[model samples]
Target chain A: MAEVEISQLHKTYPGGGRPATRDVSLTVADGEFMVLLGPSGCGKTTLLRMIAGLELPDRGSVRIGGRDVTYRAPRERNLSMVFQSYAVFPHKKVADNIGFGLAMRKADRAVIQDKIAWAAGLLQLEDYLDRYPSQLSGGQRQRVAVARAIVMEPDVLLMDEPLSNLDALLRLQFRAELKKLLTDLGTTCVYVTHDQVEALSLGERVAVMKDGEIVQCGPPMEVYDSPASEFIGGFIGSPPMNFLDATLRRDGGEAVIEVAGQRSAAPGSWAAFAEGPVRIGVRAETITAHRAERSGALRAVTEVAEPLGSTTLVTAVLGEQRIKVQVPPDFPVGAGDDLWLDLRADRLSCYERDTGRVLVSDR
Target chain B: MTAAGTAAPDRAAAPDAGVDRAPLARRRRNRMLVQVACLAITAFMAAPMYLITLAAFSTRESLNAFPKSFAPADVSTETLRSFLGATGVVPSFLNSLVVGLLTLVLSVAIGTPAGYALARHVFAGRDAYQLFLLFTRALPIVVLSVPLARFFITAGLSDTVLAVALLHTALALPTTVLITASIFTAVPRDLEEAALVFGCTRASAFRQVVAPLALPGIAAASLFTFVLSWNEVLGAAVLTLTNRTLPAQVLGSLQWSPLPYRFAGGFALLVPALIFIFVMRRYLLNMWGTTLR
Candidate 1:
C-alpha cells in the first residue's frame, strides 16, 4: 500500500564502538517485499527498526507513502510489526489478541468481530479464538501474531525474524506460508533476517548487509551469481564460494591464470590487470570433479564428503587452500581420494588479492 | 553339596536386590521426615492463635481457675464483649482500618510509576536510587517517628488517620517500589513494543498490556503495605493521640488491664490481619505462579 523511502540514516548508541547503522539508504517499492539479510550484529535489524519508527536515527529522514514520518511515533506511522518473539499478549485470548489493533482504533464492535473472524480463518486459528497464548504452541502463537498484524491492514508490515523462534521444521512451513500470505495481501513488507535461504526464497529483492553497510542488494539469483565483492560471494551460497590464491600473467595474446600449479586462460575482461597475483572465486557447484587425471585440471585431495540427497558436498584441499565442491550424490569418492577439478572458466570470478574486490566477473 | 552351593549363590544375589530397595526405603523415610517437619512447623505457628482464641472466649473466672484446661470448656463471650465495649476501642479499630486502606492506596499510587521507570529505563543514578531506597529502610522507625510527628503538627495534620497513613506509606514505599519493579521487569518489553506498533499509545499500552500482567505483583505490595500499617504501633502511637489506631489505643491501657482484657485486645488485633491475608491469598499465589513467555 505504501512505498517506504529511507535516506542517509545513521544511528550510534551511546558509549558507542562502531555505529549500529551508517549512511544507509533504501527504498522499498509499494507492495514489494524487501528483505534485509545479514549475520547477527550486522545492523540489518537496526535499519529495520529505524524504518519502523522504533529507533530514532541520528541523522536521516524516513518517508512513508510520500509523508515525512521521521519524527513520528510507532503508532502514528500506520505500520504494524511482528517481533521475533511473537509478543502476543499472554493475558488475552487469541480472538482479543487478533482484534487488539482494531479495538485500539475504536472500531465498531460488529466490524471488529468480522475482521477477527476473517483473520482467524486466514490463519487457521478459528478453533483457537477462546484460548490463551499459554495454551498455544510456538507455531500457533506466531500465527496469532501474524493475524494481529494483518487485521490492522496497515500501510506497511515490518517483521523482525518472526519465524526464528519456531522449530526448524515449523520455520520452513511458516516461511512458505508467510510468503504466500504476504503475496496474497500485497502489503509492502520489510523483513529482517539472518537467514540467507529465507532471503533468497521470500524476498523480491534481497539486501545483504555487513558491518553496518549494504554490501549488495539485488534479485536473489543476481546477487548469488554475480556477487559484487568477495565477502558477498562467500556469504550468499551453501558451502559458500571458494577462494584460491593464484598468479596471473600475460602469456602472449591471452592472460594465463595459474592456481595450484595448473594453468587456465583468464576471461577477456582481465586483460587490463598487469598481473602478479589474484584470487579466484568459484561456486562449489560450478567445478566438475573427475576421478581420472585430466589435463588443465588442478589435483585435490578430498578430506570429507557429505551426502545431502540431491548433491554431495566434498571438502578438498588443493595446494594449501581448502575448498568445497558440489558433486553428484552418487559420486564415488571419499576421504583421501584424489580428484581432478576442472574450474569452469565461465563461472569463475577473479578478485584483487589484497582488497578482496572483484577484478573480473564472467558475467 | 549341590543344594548348599546353589543356596550360597542365592544368598549372595539377595544383597544385590537389597541394594536397590535401600535407596527406595531411604527416600520414603526422607519424605516422611519432611512431612513430619512441616506438621511440626504448622503446629508451632498455629499454637498461639489457638491459645489466644480459647483464652478470649473463656469466662473471666475460668482464666483464673487453678487447673487451666487446654480444651475449650466453659466458653463465654463476656471478656470479648467487654473488650469491644471499652471506650474508644471500636473507634480506634475503625481508624486502623482507614489507615491501612489509605496506606495501601497511597503507596501503590506513588510506588508503581517509580517501579516502572526502574524496570524500563536506563537513567543515570538508577542503581544509586535503588540503593537509596534500601538505605531508607535501614533507618529504624523509632528514629523517624518524632520528626515525622513534628512535621505533621506543623502542617496541621497531626493526630489524624491521614498522619498515621502518611507515615506508614513512607515506611512501606521502599518495599512496594522494589516488589513492583521486579514484577514489571518480568513482563517482557517486547509486549509493550508490539502494542505500540499495533496502534496503542504508550499510556494505553501500559494500561492494556503491562498492568494486567503485573496486577498480582501490585496486589502483593498492597498486602504488605496494609499489614505493615495495621501492625505498626510506635509510629501510630507517636503521630496520633485522639485518632489512635487499634494497636496504639490498646497498647497504652491493655498492659495495666486484667489478663482477660489483654488477651481480648491481642486476639482482636490478630484477626483482621489474618483476614486480610486470607482475602489476598489468591492473588499472592498468582504472583508466584506466573511464568513469563
Candidate 2:
C-alpha cells in the first residue's frame, strides 16, 4: 500500500546509440494497477527493473512509499517481483520458493508457514506445495511465482510479462485470475505487458510506451478513445484505429472533412480548428457500412469481408487508403461491393497532420 | 492406414505374427551387439585397475613368478605392510593427501569468482582474459617447475608440502576456471535475479540459488583438481625434497624397487582417489534440471 513515484528516470547501456529508458516519469497511486504497455525493446521492462532496484538508473530518482531509494540494493527496497521466466528456484520445493522472501527477512517459522499457506490457497497451489518446480506445469509454476511475490506482502508488486511463457489458453485463464488476485490484495502494482487486451483488462491506468518514453498515459478507455499521438493510436488496438488524411472545412457552421470525392461531417470537436488539413482516426467499430445512396457518406470499395459469427469486419479501400469497418454479421456487404461508410463524428479523434498530436479544444 | 486400422482388432494375436517377429529378432540382435561392444570396452578399461589391485594385495612370491597369473593365488597383506613400512613412504603419503586437498581448496576459492565473472559480466578485455587463461595451459609444467623450485627455495618455502600444493594450485587453476565458468553459465542468471528481488543480495543469491544447481559441475571440477594434484610428479619432485608427494617419491625410486613393492605403493597411492570418487558419485550425477531427459 504505497505510492510509487518515479521521476525523470533514464538508463543507457554503454555503446548503445540511444538510452534504453529516457526521461520516464510516472506516479502509481496507492492500490493502483498501472500497466506499462508496449512492444518488445520499448523500455517498459527496463523501467520496471529500475524501480525494483535490480537495475540502477543512470539519471533521476525512484521513491517508494515516499522514500527515495534509487541507490539502495534490491534487498533493501522491500518490494517483490514476478519474473517473466517464472524464476522459481529449481532446488527448492514450491512451498520453499513461496516462502523465500520471508526466510530472507528471518521471519518466525509459524509466520512464514502461515503466509505460505495463505498464498498457496489463494493461488490454488496448496496441493503442489511439496512438489519441486520441475514437477509442475507452466501455469502452475507461474502461480507459484505469483505466490512467492505476494507472500512477501510488500508495499508494491512488479510483474514483467509473467504470463507470456504460458500457452494461449493458460495465459487467458491466468490473466483473469491475476486480475482478480491483484484486486483482492489491493497492493500497488506496476505491470509490464505487450498485450493490449491484457492492459485494457487489468490496468486501472494504462501507459502506452514507445522508443523509451511514455507516449500516452490515461485510463484504458481514455487512451483508446482519445489517443494523444498517432503512435499510441496505432499501437493500442487489435486491428488498430484507421487514419485517413483529409482537408477540413466549415460549411455553413457545420464541420466536415472531404475524402475520396465525398464530404462527411468530422468528429464534433474538430469544429474548433479552422479549415485546413487534419488526420482523422476512427476505430473499426465506429465506422459503419450503409447503402451507397446515403447522402454525404464517404464511398469505399470493399476488398475483403470477414464474418466472425457475431460481427462482420469489412476492409475497404477509400482514396488509396485501407480502412476496416465493423458491421453486423448479416450486413449485406462483400468483396468488390461499393458501399458508404458512415464515420461516426462523435466517436472520431482528429490529430494534426504533421505533428500527430491531438487538436484539443479549450471547451 | 487401412492395414493399421484392421490390425487394431487382432492386437492379442499380433505378438505371434511372423512378420513382426522378423523385425523384433533383428532389433534384439542389434541391441545385443551394442551391449557386447559396450561391455568389451568396459572390460578393457577395468582390467588394468583390477590387475593392479590384485597384485598389490597378493604375496611377493606370486608377484615375482614369471608368466604372471591373471587370478590371485594367495591374497596377503605382506606387500602392503612392507610398502607402508618403507622409509619416507608414509610421510610422503600423508604429504600427498595434504597437497591434494589444499590444491583443491585454493584453486576452487581463487578460480570460482573469476569463473563466475567471466561467465556473467560483460567488461572490457573479457575475451582477452579468457584467451590468457587458455594460453597459460600451453606452458609445460616441467618448464616452469625448475625456476619455481629455485624461487621457492630462495623464499624459504621449499621442501614443504605447502610449496608443492601452491605449485599444484597454479597448474590446476586454468582448467578450474574454464570448467567452472561453463558450469556457472549453465545455471541461469534469472534464478539469481529472482532471488535478489526476493530480498537476497547478489552474493547471497548466488550462494542460495546458483550454487546448489551448480554443485555437481563444481564437484566434477574439484575431482579434476584432486586427481591432477595427486598424479603430478614433475612439479612435486622439483618443488619438494623432504616432504615429497607420493607420486614424486614413488617415481624417484621406482626403478630400484621390487615388483611387489612398486605395485603395492601404486595401489596405496590410488586408494584415496578411488574413495573420493565413490564418495562424490551422487553429486556427480547429471541431475541439474528438466532440460535433460
Candidate 3:
C-alpha cells in the first residue's frame, strides 16, 4: 500500500468562468480510506482525478509512495479507478476485464488466471466470469468494474461515486461489502461522493468540500456533531441542522441567548463573541418539545408533522424562522399545535448572522 | 345530484367498448397501409436488378423479340459469355477490384485518425475544419478531375491504378470522416478513461477499446469507398488509358456496342457492388443499434 500526498492543486477549464478546484490539498496515509464528500460540481471528482493523473492540475504536486507524479499519465501513476458508470469493457468477458491490467503489465499467464479467480471470488462474481458486461445486470457490472480495479493491486484506488448508479438496496449492500473488502485489503483509497451517508459509513475520515475548497476534514462522527461552519452543519445532516435568528448577550460572565422572547443559557464558548445578532444552530434530534409553557423554553407553533417510522419530524414556526425537530415516533403532535421547545445548550452551535461563520470556538 | 353522478358514469362506460374497438380497427388498417408501402418500396428497388439479370442471361435473339416475356424461357448464358469473352473486359474487371480495395485502405487509414480527432478533441478550428471537409465535396468532381489528371501526369503517376485509387480516396474522404466521427462519438468516453487507469496508454486504449467498438462503422465507410471507386467513370476515364477500371473501360465501348452487350456490362458492374453490400450489411445493422446493449 502507498500513501497519497497532494498539495496546492488548482485547475480551471479553459472556457469555464470559475475554477473547478481552488488550491486543494489533501493527504491519505498508507492504507487509509479517505472520502471527499460534497454536492455536485463541488470539485470532489476533479480532486480525485488529479490524484489519479487523469487530469493535470494547473498548479500543484501529487506524490504517491513518495514519488512525484503530478505530470505523469494515469497509467504511469500506478493507480486504478472505478467510474460511476461502471465502465467495464463491453467487448471483453468478466474474466478478461479483471485480468486486463495484469495482461497489460505482461504478467505470467498463470498469475493472471489466479488473480482473476481471486478477484472474482472476492466480488462474488465467480459465476459471471464468462459473461460480457452487456449481459449482466447493473449491480453485476459494477461488481465487475470493482473487481477489475482491485485485481490491479495498484498503489491507490480512486472511486468517483461508484455506487451512485446502483439501486438503493444494492448500493447499501455493496457499500457495506466494499467497506469491509477495502479495509481487509488495506488499500489506500481516495473516494469522491455526493452522498453523505456513504461518506459517513465508508470513510475512516471524511473531507467535506464546498465551492471548490475543503471546508472541514475529520472523523465522521466529529464532523457530524461539531461542524466547522453553518454551511457544513446544514450540508452534512438530514433534516439539516436548523438555524434560528437570535441575539447573544453577556450577563454576569454567562452567555445568555434570547430567541422569540425567551432567554436561555448558551454554550460557554459563545461568551467570547461580542453581544450582537447571531444565529443559533441546533440539530433536529437535539431539541425536545413540551406541551406546556416552561421557563427558558422558546414558544413555537407546529406547521407540519411527518412520521418517519423511527422518528417524527416536526416543522415548527418560531418567530419568523422555520425549524425542524425530530421527536419520538409516538409523540402526539400535528399542525397548528403550540409547543414549547427546549434547545440543548451543550449541543447548540452559535453562528454570526452576517457571515454564517461559527462564533464559538472549534470543538 | 347522486342519481346524476351515477348516471354519468354509466353513460361514459357504455361507449368505452366501442371506443376501444374503433382504435383497434384503425390500428389494423394503419398496419396494413404500412405493409403495402413497404412492399411498394421493395419492389421499386428490386425491379431493375430483376430486369438486368434476365436480360443478361437471355438468348441474344430474345432482345429483339417484340412483346418481350418477363418470365424466364430461353435462359442461355450466350450474351453474358460473349460479353466476358470481349477483349479487355476481364483485365478491366481485375483493375477495378485493385482500385476499389486500394481506395478502401488508403481512405480509412487516412480518414479514421482525422475522424477520431474530430470526435475526441476540442482543438482550435475544429468546427472550421469539419466545414472545410464538406466544402471540398461541394467542388464538382467534373471540374476537379481534369486538373487532377494533369497534376497526376506531372507527378509521373498518370495512367495507373494507383492514380485512380488516389482520386477515389479524395472523393470518398469527407463522407468517410464524417461517418467515422459519429461512430467514435457514440463510444462512451468513460471506457477509454477506465482503460487508461488500468495501465493502457492513450494509443493502446483506443486500439483495444475504441477500435473494436468502431469496427462496424468503419466497415460501412469502407463499403461506401469501395463501391464509389468501382463505379466512378469520369475521374477514372480522365486519369487512365490502358489501366482503366471496368466502368471507365466499358463506358467508352458500351455506347457503341449492341444492346445485349450493354446489358451484360451493366450486370457485371452491378454484381460486385451488390456483393460488397451483402458482405457489409451485418456491420451496417450493428451501426444502427444492436451493439453494446
Best by TM-score: 3
Candidate 3 Cα outliers beyond 4 Å, as residue runs = B1-15, B18-39, B285-293
Give the Cα error of residue A333 in candidate 1, in Å. 1.0
DockQ of 1: 0.74
Chain A only, candidate 3, TM-score: 0.97
* Candidate 3 per-residue lDDT over residues B178-231, each given as its tens digit: 878878888899999998888889999999899998887888878988999998
Which tens-of-lDDT digit does each residue in A1-363 have in candidate 2?
A: 799999999999788899999999999999999999998999999999999987899999999999999989988888899999999998999999999999999999999999999999999999999999999999999999999999998999999999899999999999999999999999999999999999998999999999999988999999998899888889888779998898899887778898865799876666779788888889999887896668867888999999998899899999898998889999998789998888888888888999999888875
Clashing pairs in 1: none
Each candidate: RMSD: 5.2, 5.1, 5.0
Ten consecutive residues with minimal summed lDDT in candidate 2 chain A? Answer: A265-274
Q: Alpha-carbon error at B10 in model 3, in Å?
A: 21
Please give, for residues A1-363, the per-residue lDDT of candidate 3 as tens digits: 899998999999888889999998888999999999999999999999899888889998999999999999999988899999999998999999999989999999999999999999999999999988888999999999999999889899999999999999999999999999999999999999999999999999999999889999999988888888899898888988898899999999999999877798898877788998898889999999988999888899999999999999999998878999998999999899998999889998888888898765644
DockQ-superior candidate, 1 or 2: 1
User: Candidate 1: misplaced stretches above 4 Å?
Assistant: A360-363, B1-44, B65-74, B282-293
Candidate 2, superposed: residue stretches over 4 Å from native: B1-87, B260-293
Error of 3 at B23 (Å): 7.2
DockQ of 2: 0.72
How well does chain A score by TM in each candidate? 0.96, 0.98, 0.97
